[model samples]
Target: MTSPASPYVGRFAPSPSGPLHLGSVVAALASWLDARAHGGRWLVRMEDVDGPRTVPGADQVILAQLAALGMTSDDDVIYQSSRHAVYEAALARLTAMGLIYPCGCTRREIADSAPIHAVSGERPYPGTCRTGLQPGRGPRAWRVRMPAGVHCFEDRWLGRQCQDVAREVGDIVLRRADGQWAYQLAVVIDDADQGVTDIVRGADLLSSTARQQVLGQTLGLPLPRVMHVPLIVDTDGRKLSKQNGAPAVDTQAPLVALQAAWTALGFAPLPDASTAAAFLTQATDAWRLRWHIHPCSA
Candidate 1:
């Protein structure tokens, strides 16, 4: 669907750290089903912003995994690695607006004082580098000045959600000391640029929504609708991830893999389909009914 005509534009952005584990597939499948449910477009993005975490050839491998499951990007998939200039321009605008500043505090120094986030379990910065850098200290990174008040939005799955960005997240990093771009900045810019109208992802990212909403406001971009699906956890109750050594989805039997992912999305197992494509079609129809979404003309 074209940007203006599409009723919904969803995406699944996977980091090229390793491969698509079961958790990653759950997010990918949900985004694909939601896009199909609305007769909209589904795009894929490689979030290899952090070069250190990226593995060579991992992007293609992940794409292959999705293809095996009958999922593929609608448009030419974009990689964050190729969009440095755009991110720089966004940073420039925030700087021109006096909303971003150099952060000089090191992790050890900040960890000694800042409080941890309740839900996300991340240590919220205390704005130690907010006012100005210490006398002789130099800028190690850059941070957005979290404005006062709350940013609110309704998630398709989570209902009404709100977060005090200033208090809970504090000033967030836009770029790290190692020159790696921040996920928040890159994602907001990418989604706006790609005209993504809906975002269906894992619950682990739910906490980053308000921070992104505030960033989008600063950038004068439209906020996309979102739905966060439940995460697939391991025996230890931690979310499965590439970094956690979660094995790649076994694509040898595509139907079985697809059924497992479907069930993880809170759906009952579908009757055996002849092919992965057939299974996806059934899943999309069920997804549309579950979400009460009528097929859009686009």
Candidate 2:
């Protein structure tokens, strides 16, 4: 746990693959409000590590949308694309520690070797390449070895949670076959580098926290307080995402969008605020009241 005397630091990291949609706004607003409520520094990061997927000019559009909604970062935005050297250094350190190994398995090959359950839908790796690879196979990606046993952590909203990475997730990839850094590896390093003390994001990413915690422990990095808010889903009960055709937020009427996001977070209607800034001020106060009752305290 972070000492109360240590300053709180939070961030909103958005992928530049698409515009800021309603679900994106809700996530951004929640993180922003949480930072403000704690008097913390809020920062933004462009998650453009997947070079091929990043759309040109999407980062600017996302920043513009945040500014229009009266949610601005306290520092200059950091781009993950420019931080490859840092990731390389971390990978080298892990390699020296013998935690990382080269793997040559493809997705289809792994799925065929270890079929994922339809209900659980988890594709836990079967340690196909844990030992020396087959004679015909060649290395394609880098994977980190997972230790056996249960890894547990407390979530501010979800309460106590546990996962066994070795049995469930298996050895995860650090670098992909396509030469892109895996999201898990990059995010763990980024949060530690930025001194992020609090993480507030959609619940869709809750399952990933345990893996990241294991990586953080391996690297001897400080673990941040995590809060996974409910996701904004569509009529089909699927989480709204760019791939699902979720539309870009209406920046022309930013306050209306802000109000919708506020309500989605289970907050009561705003107190007749005259402007978007005023509504955010009232929302920040409300967030503070709710933060005190978070499950982490219990």
Per-model CA lDDT versus the true structure? 0.89, 0.89
RMSD of candidates 1 onward, in order: 2.1, 2.5
Cα shift from native, residue 161, model 2 (Å): 1.1
Worst 10 residues of 2 by lDDT: 289-298
| Model 2 TM-score, 2 decimals | 0.95
Misplaced by over 4 Å in model 1 are 1-6, 296-298
| TM-score, candidate number 1 | 0.96
lDDT of 2: 0.89
Cα TM-score per model: 0.96, 0.95
* Candidate 1 local lDDT, 1-298, one digit each (tens): 1243546778999999998999999999999998898888999999999998899999999999999999999989899999999999999999999998899988998888876878557788898878898899999999999889988888989899998888887899999777889999999999999989999999999999999989998888988888899999999999998778898999988898999899998899988677898999889888988988755542
lDDT of 2 by residue, 77-194 (tens): 9999999999999999999999898898988988898867443358888988888787898888999999999999899889998888777788999997677999999999999999
